[model samples]
Target chain A: QKEVEQDPGPLSVPEGAIVSLNCTYSNSAFQYFMWYRQYSRKGPELLMYTYSSGNKEDGRFTAQVDKSSKYISLFIRDSQPSDSATYLCAMKFNYGQNFVFGPGTRLSVLP
Target chain B: DAGVTQSPTHLIKTRGQQVTLRCSPKSGHDTVSWYQQALGQGPQFIFQYYEEEERQRGNFPDRFSGHQFPNYSSELNVNALLLGDSALYLCASSEYGIHTDTQYFGPGTRLTVL
Candidate 1:
């Protein structure tokens, strides 16, 4: 099994809606969790970052991690058309250097 | 400030041919990491370079190699490339020794192996 799993969602929602994207990992040792946004033909941009299990908020984006369940999520409030992109979850062990990224979920917020 | 920059924005090569891609890190950043992103997938870590040496590597094969120059610029070389090697190659830079460092990525080089 792949260490990390995420729904390859082409999820579409209207503007002003709330969006939730999630990922699950098999490794219990992962301590650093991150969410990245990637537009078509562009590199992944770091959106939210969290250490261990907790929630971190930046603007309209909120990242939540549940270490016990090995599940993580990113919530986008008042989603906009500009928010349409692929969201990726990445994690790493505390002592490890490499970050493993999940197969991203594609989102499209329409007007 | 200019962000990370990669050369040869797009490339096409035949299977078994070699390819070299280049990257210059962001200003004040000393560490560089390379990633491969295939179609419909997220980027996968290839390796990282710091202090002119490879600091970490992922599960890539020996055919993939890299170099870091004194200026902190880096090169990724793939020898005897296979069709599977075709993917978007990204270069990310971050400061070493900074706790919980965030990587800044460049517009990746799109590599296509025929």
Candidate 2:
């Protein structure tokens, strides 16, 4: 099984709606969880970052991690057309080390 | 400040041909990491360079090699490339010794092996 698993979602939602993107990992050693946003033909941008199991809020994006379940999630509130992109979850055991990335979920917030 | 910069934004090569991609890390950053992203997939870590040496490597084959110059710039060279070698190559930079350092990525070089 892949170290990280995420649904390849082409999930479509209306503007102003709440969207939840999630990922699960098989490696319990992963301690740092991160969410990245990538637009078409662009590099991935860091959206949210969390260490261990906890919740972190930044602007309209909230990242939640449950170490016990080896799950992580990114919640986008008041989604906008600009939010349409691929959401990727990544995790690492040590700083500046190799990070495992999920397949990513494609999201489109339609107007 | 300029983020990580990759050269040859796009490239096309034939099977069995070799390819070299270049990257200059962000200002004040001393570490560089390379990743390969296939179509519709997340970037896969290839290797990382710090202090002019490879500190970590992923599951890639020996055909994939890299070099880090004294200036902290890096190069990823693939020999005997196959069709599967075609992918978007990304370069990320971060400051060594910074515990919470997040990697800043470049626009990436798109490689197409024919």
Candidate 3:
């Protein structure tokens, strides 16, 4: 099985809608979970970062990690057209080592 | 200060050829790591360089090699590249080592193997 699994979603939603992106991992050793946003032809940018099993909120984005189930999620409230991009979930052990990445979910927020 | 910067924003090369991509880490940063991102896929770790020495490597073969200069600049060299080597090469810089450091990424160089 892949270390990290994420649905490659081209999920489309109207502006102002709430968006939920999720990823699951098989490795329980992963302690640092991160969400990255990537636009077309661009490099992935750090969006949200969380350690262990907890929730971290940054402005309109919230990252939740559940170590018990090895599940992670990124919730975007009040989505905007500019929010359209690929959302990737990455995870690593304590000090970042071989960060495994998910396939990324493609999201499009229409105006 | 400038963020991570990559040179040759885009390039096209034929199979069996060699290519070198460059990256300059963010100002005052020390560690540099490289990743390969294919179309519609997330970036995969290639390797990392710290203190001008190879620190960690991914599943990639020996054909994929890198070097870190004294100034914290880096170069990723692919020898005898294959068509599968076509991907976006990314460079991420961090202030400290990979452990417990937040990585800042460059714009990345898009490579096309023809």
Candidate 4:
């Protein structure tokens, strides 16, 4: 089994809607979880990160992690057309380890 | 305070060729990490360098290697490149263990192998 799993989605939603993207991992050692946004032909940008099992909110994005189940999520509120991009979930152990990324989910917020 | 910057924004090469991509980390950063992203996949960690040494590496083969200079800049070199090696190479930088949660990435170097 892959260490991380995420649905490859081209999820389409209308503007102003709420969207939720999730990923699950098999490793319990992963302590730091992160979400990244990438546009077409562009590099991935750090969206947000969380070390705890709860939620971390930044502007319109919220990242949630559940270490017990090894599940993580990124929720977007009032999604906009500019929010359309690929969302990647990545995680790592503590320091001194390279991060493992999940297959990203593509999102399109139609205006 | 520029973000991470990579050289030769795009490159095209043939099988059996060798290529080297460079990256300059963000100002004040000291650690550098490399990742590879295929056409439709998420970025995969290649390796990471700290203190001019490789601190960690991923599952990539020996054909892929890297170097980090004293300035915290890095280079990703591929030898005997294969078509499967075509991908976008990304460089990320952070302040060694202090601000790892905020590792920043460059625009990435798009490598094409024919």
Candidate 5:
């Protein structure tokens, strides 16, 4: 199985809609789960990170990690065109330096 | 506070050539990690450096190497590059010894290998 898996979505959503992005991993040992957003011609910007299970919310973004299911999610509320970009899920083992990234999901938010 | 910065925003090279990309990490951060992102793909881990030493590396070949300086800056060197090396090379910075320190990324250098 792939270490990390995400739907390479070209998901389209209208303005003010709720957008949900998710990823699953085969490795149960991953402790740090991160969500990154990348615009065209730009490097990834870290959106949110979760240490273990449960949910974390910041502004319009909310991240959830369920270690038991090896699943993680990012929810964007009231999405705007600016929120359109490639969303990537990355995770790493405890005390490990490298991150294993899943194939990003491309999102397009329409005005 | 300045964020992580990388130089030569774009580069072009041919097969079998060598390229060196530089990075200045975010201030107060001592660890630097490199990643390669091809078109339509997520960034792939290249390696990490701390204390001017290589701490961890990914599955890339030996032709891909890196060096860290005392000032917490770094360089990624690709020897005998292949067409597949065409991608955006990113440098990320984080503090050492912090289990949960977030990595701040630079804008990245785009390399096109023909």
Candidate 6:
């Protein structure tokens, strides 16, 4: 099984809708979790990162991690058209040199 | 402050050719990491460089290698390139070492191997 797994979604939602993207990992060693947004043909842009099983909130994005279940989520409130992009979940062990990333989910907030 | 910067922005190469992509880490950053992103997939870690030394590597083959300079810049070199090598090569930089959660990325180098 892959260490990190995420649904490859082409999820479409209307503008202003709340969107939730999730990822699950099998490794319990992961202590740092991150969410990134990628535009078409662009590089991954760091959205937010959390240290462990907790929640971190930004302006419009919220990242939640549940270490017990190895599940993490990114929720977007009042999504906008410009918010359309691919969301990737990444994690790594404490002091681990390399980060493992999920397959990513494509999101389109239509007007 | 300028974020991580990579070049050439785009490249096209034939199979069996070799290519070198460059990256300038974010100002005041000391670590650089490279990743490969293929169509419909997330970025996969290639390797990381710190203090002009190869710090860590991913599952990629030896054909994928890198170097770090004293200035905290980096390069990703692919030898005996295959069509499968066609993808976006990304460079990320961070002030701290591997444990830094604030790693930042460049725009990326898009490579097309024919």
- List TM-scores for all candidates, in order: 0.97, 0.98, 0.97, 0.97, 0.98, 0.97
Give the DockQ (C-alpha) for candidate 2: 0.78
Query: Model 1 over residues A1-111: C-alpha lDDT tens digits?
Result: 899999998999999999999999998999899999999988888898789899999999999999999999999999999999999999888533678999999999999
Model 1 chain A: ten consecutive residues of lowest lDDT: A91-100
Report the alpha-carbon TM-score of model 1 versus the true structure: 0.97
DockQ of each: 0.66, 0.78, 0.70, 0.67, 0.73, 0.66
Q: In model 6, what are the clashing residue pairs, if there are any?
A: none
Lowest-sum lDDT 10-residue window in model 6 chain B:
B94-103
C-alpha RMSD by candidate, in order? 1.0, 0.8, 1.1, 1.1, 0.8, 1.2
Give per-residue lDDT, candidate 4, residue B106.
94
**Candidate lDDT (C-alpha), each:** 0.93, 0.94, 0.92, 0.91, 0.94, 0.91
**Candidate 3 at residue A111, lDDT?**
95
Question: In lDDT terms, how accurate is model 1?
Answer: 0.93
Over the stretch A14-77, how does candidate 6's per-residue lDDT look in tens digits? 9999999999999898899999999998888999988978899999999999999989999999
- Which runs in model 2 stand beyond 4 Å of their true positions? none
Candidate 6 positional error at A109, Å: 0.3
lDDT of 6 at B71: 94
In model 1, where do residues sit more than 4 Å from their true spots? none
lDDT of 3: 0.92
True contacts kept of each: 0.63, 0.72, 0.76, 0.65, 0.65, 0.67
lDDT of 2 at B82: 99
Instruction: Give the total clashing residue pairs for model 2.
Output: 0
How many residue pairs clash in all the candidates, one count each? 0, 0, 1, 0, 0, 0
lDDT of residue B32 for candidate 4: 94
Residue B64 in model 3: shift from native, Å?
0.6
Residues A1-111 of candidate 2: C-alpha lDDT, one tens digit per residue:
998999998999999999999999998999989899999888898898788899999999999999999999999999999999999999999787777899999999999
Runs with alpha carbons beyond 4 Å of true place in candidate 4: none
TM-score of candidate 6 restricted to chain B? 0.95
